[model samples]
Target: AQSVTQPDARVTVSEGASLQLRCKYSSSVTPYLFWYVQYPRQGLQLLLKYYSGDPVVQGVNGFEAEFSKSNSSFHLRKASVHWSDSAVYFCAGQNTGGADRLTFGKGTQLIIQP
Candidate 1:
């Protein structure tokens, strides 16, 4: 079985500050790592994904993540976040085959302080 752990359940950041969200995963084989962001009452949007090749992957909205095989971790980072960036962030993993469903962490709620 595959699973993911998000250390922090919530994070608060003032506007214009950098943000880093941690994610740890456990899988039998190389997992397809992904970061998704969700606005209130909205579906999740793909932030970034690390399938293979490069260890680092970039996503929309100035977000990026680095995949560490040894540590089994994929962390999301944003250089500067705006008020609009305040949303729920989720760390997800999928098996190599598409048959398996995506496993997501509880999620990290981001609160932006004006």
Candidate 2:
């Protein structure tokens, strides 16, 4: 079984501040990893993903993440976040043999303060 853990349920950050969202997972093998962002009433958009090869992956809207096999972690980072970046972020995974069933965390709601 594959699972993910997002330590924070909500995060508040000042506009233009650097941000890091923590994510940890439990799996016997490396699975397809991804970060999705959901705005007010919109659907989830893929931020980034890691299938194989490079450990570092870049995403849309100035988002990035690094995958660590040893720690079983994939943390999202941004040098600076805008007010519009205030949205719910979810960490998800897909198993190779599961026909791509996405497993999502509880999600982290990010609030931006001016």
Candidate 3:
């Protein structure tokens, strides 16, 4: 089974500060990792993904993630964040050999301080 865990339930950062959201995954085999963001009352939008090739992949809005097989982690990072970046972030994983369904974490709510 593939599962994702986001230890932090909520994160607060200054408007211009850097941000990092933690994610850990477990699977029998290599898994497809993803980070999805959900704005207020809006559907989830993919922030980044990692399947193969590079361990680090760039995403929309200057977001990026690094995958580590040894650690079973795919953590999202941003150099600087804005108020609009405040949202709920979900860490998801899909077993390459299994169904197309994605197993997601509980979610981490991002709050930007003024």
Candidate 4:
């Protein structure tokens, strides 16, 4: 079985500071990795994903992720974070066996400090 783990349950950072959200996964083989964000009252939105080819994929709003098969990690990074960037972020994994299912992490709540 495949699974995702987010070691940090919550993180606080000052505005304009760089941010990195850690994610680790366990699977039989390298699975498709994804990062999603959820606003206050909005549904989860895809930030970025990695299936193959490039290890680093660009995401929306200055977000990008690097997939590492060696470490079985797909961490998300932001050059600079804003107040509006505060939200709950989730990392998910889908097996390449053609299943439409995705295993999600517990999620990390990002808080911005003034």
lDDT for each residue of candidate 4 in 31-81, tens digit (9 for 90 to 100)? 688999999999999999998999999999999999998898999999999
lDDT of 3 by residue, 23-83 (tens): 9998643568999999999999999999999999999999999999999999999999999
| Residue 74 local lDDT, model 2 | 90
- 2 or 3, greater by lDDT: 3
Q: Order candidates by TM-score, high to low.
A: 3, 4, 2, 1
| Candidate 2 residue lDDT tens string, 1-114 | 437889999999999999999888888334689999999999999999989888999999989999998989999999998999999999987754667677788899999999
True-structure RMSD, every candidate:
1.8, 1.7, 1.6, 1.6
Residue 13: error of model 2 in Å?
0.9
Candidate number with greatest TM-score: 3
Clashing pairs in 1: none
Q: Alpha-carbon error at 60 in model 4, in Å? A: 0.3
Q: How would the candidate models be sorted by lDDT, starting from the highest?
A: 3, 4, 1, 2
lDDT of each: 0.89, 0.88, 0.91, 0.91
Which parts of model 1 have CA positions greater than 4 angstroms off?
96-98
Candidate 4 has its poorest 10 consecutive residues by lDDT at 94-103
Per-candidate TM equals 0.91, 0.92, 0.93, 0.93
lDDT (Cα, tens digit) per residue for candidate 1, span 63-98:
999999899999999998899998999999885566
